[model samples]
Target chain A: MSAALRLHRADTQPPADLAGEFLARLDRRLHLPQPHRRQVLDELACHLDERVRDLMVTGVTEEQATRRAVEELGDPMVLARRFERAHVAPRRRRIMNMLMVGLASAAALTGAMTLRAPQVTIRSAVYPPPDAVQQVPQKPLDVQGLPPDVQWGDFFSLAASTSGKSPVVHWGALRELDSDNFGPGHSLGIDPLVDQKLTLDQFLELINTEKGFVADNRIEYREEEGRLVFATTHYFDRRETRLVTYDVSELLRARLGGDADNPDRVPGAVHEIADLIRALVESGMWDVNGGSASITTYGTKLFVRVPQRLLPRIEWVLEQAADAHIGAHQGASVDRRQGDPLHTPRDGAALPPAAGSSTVVSVQLQRVDPAAARQILNQAFDGVPSLKQCSVARWITVDASSRTVSVSATQRHAEFVGRLLTMLDRPGADVVASAESSMQVIPLARVSSETMDSLIRAIAGGSTLYGREFRLVANPQQNSVIVEGPTGVVTALQELIALLDTDWEEPAKVGAAIGR
Target chain B: MLHKDAQRDQAELVILSLLDAQGPLYGYAISKEVSGRSDGQLRLTPGVLYPLLKELESEGLISGSVEEVHSDRKEAAPDAAEGRKRKWYRLTARGRKRLAARIEAHRTWRRVIDLFIARDPMDHDQKEHGR
Candidate 1:
């Protein structure tokens, strides 16, 4: 009789004592209702019996086969755990469901409260009053009699409460006036104005002078409607002009012709350089051109009387000229004298050595647009110390009308920009000469020709900006694409087509199909 | 080594596909068929197979029916008490649809991975040099 038949006949009787014990252990751990437990045990018993029968057919004795089959079934506890995981909801999941419901209830309650409390303003408790207020007449307080060591807050509060004229503290203007005056943790105490006894007007003046708040008449006591009113001034009312002396002796020496030793040439070179400065700098700001800015020469120096904002631009132009002249005459030794100290337009800090020195060069782009070239050069030179010290965009001018980029940068920066521009401005003739155009017919095996055609068109069209000329035609009849383009683009397309034209296969089909 | 979770998911797909191909099969028969087909390289031990089968059946992807195995002896009646019963499992209609979706998803995932693998590193270096 077949082993399976023999096993079935044996199953009609009670199972072997060992098999029965294994089943009982599994049944105990199953933790199911009687009907369900019986069903699972029956299924496991049938599986064990069949396994024993198969093993017996392979020349194993019945007792050994039964033991082997039981051993292969694995630990009953582990099997029970697996069965429990499949059949029952885990404790963690049940807790998570309860937590989710709790959160939903809280959210719903909050939403209902929001709908009911629509009129709530929710304003901050510590709202700051407006920094500036209209001047109002109030009785004067004898601030001079106050103690010298009084705290600033108490002093201001005493003055405001007694005189009924609260001092309008322009905090932003104060920070701009002198950031160092208010040191760390000194916001409530005016450190510089401490330990001083003066009249109210004199005290305000001391605060203004000691803190360097006198610039642009920012802080002052003015008599209006027969009352002394303290106010901080605004620059928007009028533009301030300042006289700055730039020592361009090095630049004047470089501009001198063959008659370098002539005394007459010195004045002429100075005037010429001065005129060039006036022409190169912002025209609208120059005084001679109906603007506030004016330029004149004194020996080898250029005295420029312009608005405070125009100082940096004039300095940038002179520095560029000096750099170019010095670069042209390698052996030239020109004297560089420090100019008078001037406040930087940005933060009014003392100016550093003419922020940046650059050589001026005009490039006529053959292919790249001037605007695009400027963008690329800006990105390349971003975060450069010299570029960051001064404004990069100010030194680089793009003339889209003439397709020219005029760059005033240091020699190293100039060279980098030139090389980058050369790479970017790839003319059709240059590309053809360097890497000749080629024709490629790539067959589509996986993707449709129409799909690849559209994809190649989208990809290759973007490459045209790099001076890569290409034409693509999809041959639907043969399921192929014909490409005629620069060798690099064609080769790239070929690589892309080869990669994309592939059959999709499962990761480990053979191994997975082998089953384990 | 495959993670336990990933191995379990792969086993689910394999089992579903097997049932679709082989029709109704008892637990032991299914295990034997898998072992034989894979040349003993894959062994679906009872502990793994029974739990996965139960889970699949609970999910409604597969349905099971109990069948009685009568003795082959001529004297045995069809309704005889001398018979051992076994549960047979077969793929439901939902199971077939799920198998098809899983296969498509696996192919798409493999295609994406192959795209990255097929890229030539030397070509990428050359392109970078050209730039």
Candidate 2:
């Protein structure tokens, strides 16, 4: 019998005297008769007698000892409580075990041990696409993602793949770290590169080859006129060490309408930019604010990071180019842009760069709500299966078109794209390579805010963003979309817009760089 | 031989009250007292008390000490020699207090009942005569 049940038995009779020993002290926790009490003593007789003998050593009379033992035993209430707690879990386990036993017994009576499996499947969905809006002329086009000012053959000019890669798995789900083999019992995994294992060396090697950089970037102060410009320049680049002289002096002298400040920065490409500024002014597109022109310098590529100022003019030039090339000469479907959130920016015209600098253009919409911006970003991953469910909030996105890198938010989204960058970043995450990918945000609210007037002010100012395009404008009437981009880029942009609209049924949001 | 536990009622009132208050006791310690004074009955049972102790414990209102029961008896039969056991318990404070109060209330009832025995024989007869 369980110890608990025995203690519960009445100690009133049987060895009725012994009953006095345990029962007397037994809390009248339960009221019982002579026989019932005896039953308790019978069960506890051995124990009671042992206690009696123990009291004998305390120097009491034999009878007294037995009685004292009973008295010393104290409260039955305490004993009852004690016994109950000790047995609860065991009792529960026993009940489960007994249930299992009963099931097994019934099974034995029949004789079968087969089990059945469950079924599973995969699913997908897509929304409607949008229409294209009108185009605003572009002055100096945003040529980013096309590889520095160098002439590119095509988008796939540098399509090379590297090997020695490992299949990635989440640390939480690593095979060797299986729960059964975990805890203090297990030692280190035998092979570093086992099924789900990765060695630090192999991981680091992957990062160096794939990630390409491990240094922290710093912002340098350079004097543009008398103003201190907070700009990030890779001063460590080996090429910056050499002070090479080119015919920049002669070019600056011939091109400048006024005195030049810095002489050292001039030379090869600076001379070419000086010549270009003269051409834009002659064409009358330069917007002169007071006596100064908004001159910004940055590399020109399909996804280049142009300075924040010239984005308006650059957007304008791209629009003009696209207007000229798209539809008519570029053909009906040639340089189409996915008019996802296409609109003309309200900013002044493009102007000449500072004396000797190659002008870099940039555009940005200020106070972009993180949520709206995120929703807009979601447009990029719409069709891709893995990224369809990816959180726009948590993805490390690089807008090759805008030259801006926004950090991904972590927890909110669970799509494969959620971990894409993080997994590709540090040594642990085995990202094979890093490349530029451009995407347009949908919904003006998704880019800036649903608040219209402020969004307009934000676009025109152009000072809010680092490298952003003009403000996005929507003609609630025609459902049109207009954007500034090279004719080909604009065409592609239109296709992207159409894909979104056709897939999502959203009206076109056109973007261009108009006068401030 | 079994007449040993006759004082159980007397001792029980006190013990139950303590159990009611403190709730659930270990074997040997339950044989000792935490609160409440002893009656003249020399009734302390470490051995036999354990089994019955174990019994009432199973009935639930009270639980028992789980930490291995150690026998502090320096000299013990091998059957009982799992030395130096300590007992613990889980008691609803309500149960202990109630038990403790019940013991006191029961004693008061017993004292009232005793008044009948102390009454004059004639009065006792007349009291029952109301029937």
Clashes of each: 2, 145
Recovery fraction of native interface contacts for candidate 2: 0.10
What is the overall TM-score of model 2 with all chains considered together? 0.19
Top candidate, metric DockQ: 1
What are the interface RMSDs of all the models? 14.0, 19.1
Error of 1 at A82 (Å): 1.3
**lDDT (Cα, 0-100) at A33 in candidate 2:** 50
lDDT of 2 at A101: 27
DockQ of each: 0.14, 0.04
lDDT of 2 by residue, B45-117 (tens): 5433454444334534356444444434323223334432244545553334324434544554455457567
Error of 2 at A351 (Å): 90
